[model samples]
Target: LAKTTQPISMDSYEGQEVNITCSHNNIATNDYITWYQQFPSQGPRFIIQGYKTKVTNEVASLFIPADRKSSTLSLPRVSLSDTAVYYCLVGVGTGANNLFFGTGTRLTVIP
Candidate 1:
């Protein structure tokens, strides 16, 4: 498993764009970058993922550089509801149960 590095915390106002970056220098070629959001007392939910280049979904966008050494998660027009702990992971496994967990980036969205 590759280790990911993220900010300890972040702050933002409502209707703002929030970008969280994760670093994984030892990532394998088959590994994919995945981000998850977890609220208090709840399991983390998948946000976005990508192997290389970029991937976007309804909630966020994932940008992966050519080296796959790092990735950034972008959230547009965030609200207080988006406040949560965001985690970044690098792995080739599929399914929620197969994913590994680590300390995540805590995002605080203010009104």
Candidate 2:
């Protein structure tokens, strides 16, 4: 498993764009970069995933460098309801045991 590092916390005002970056220097070839958002007392929800380059969905966008050692999750026009703990996971499969968790970044969206 690739160990990921993310910011401890972040503060953003409503209607602002927020980018949270994660670094995994020891990433593996088969590993896929995935991001999840978790509210207090709730299981993490999938935000985005990418192997390389950029991938955008309705909720967020994921940017993975060619080296695959780092990734960024971009949230456009964040609101107070978007406040949560964001997790970056690097692994081979989507199975529960395959993914490892780290201390997530807490995003506080101010009104």
Candidate 3:
């Protein structure tokens, strides 16, 4: 299990592109980077995952370098509704027991 470090908070205005980077210096070869977004009183939802290079979905894009020790989650043209806590998780693909919770990056979207 690799520990993730992210900013304590971030602020962005509506219609802005936000990129949140996470650092995992102790990542393992079998580890993958996974990102999640959570709203108030709700569980975290999977945003994206990647091993290397770039992976994109309807909502966000994930970028991983060849070293695989760090990742960036990119949200395009965010709105006020996009404000939430974002988490970066680094670990092998296992069951729930392998998951570790850490302080997430609080993203505030302003109008």
CA lDDT of each candidate? 0.88, 0.91, 0.89
lDDT of 2: 0.91
Task: State residue 8's C-alpha deviation in candidate 3, in Å.
Answer: 0.8
Best first by lDDT, ranked: 2, 3, 1
- List the pairs of residues colliding in candidate 1: none
How well is each residue in 2-106 modelled by candidate 3, as lDDT tens digits? 888899899999999999999998888888889999999999999898889999999999999888878999999999989999999888866554465468899
Steric clash count of candidate 2 = 0
Candidate 1 structure quality by residue, lDDT tens digits, 1-111: 577889999999999999999999878877888898999999989888899998998888999999988899999999999999999987775644435555789999999
Please give the lDDT score at residue 109 for candidate 3: 95
Q: What range of 10 consecutive residues in model 1 has the weakest lDDT sum?
A: 93-102
The estimated TM-scores of all candidates read 0.91, 0.94, 0.93
Distance from true location, Cα of 28 in model 3, Å: 0.6
- Residue 19 miss distance in model 1 (angstroms): 0.5
Model 2, 47-66: lDDT tens digits are 88889999999999999988
TM-score of 3: 0.93
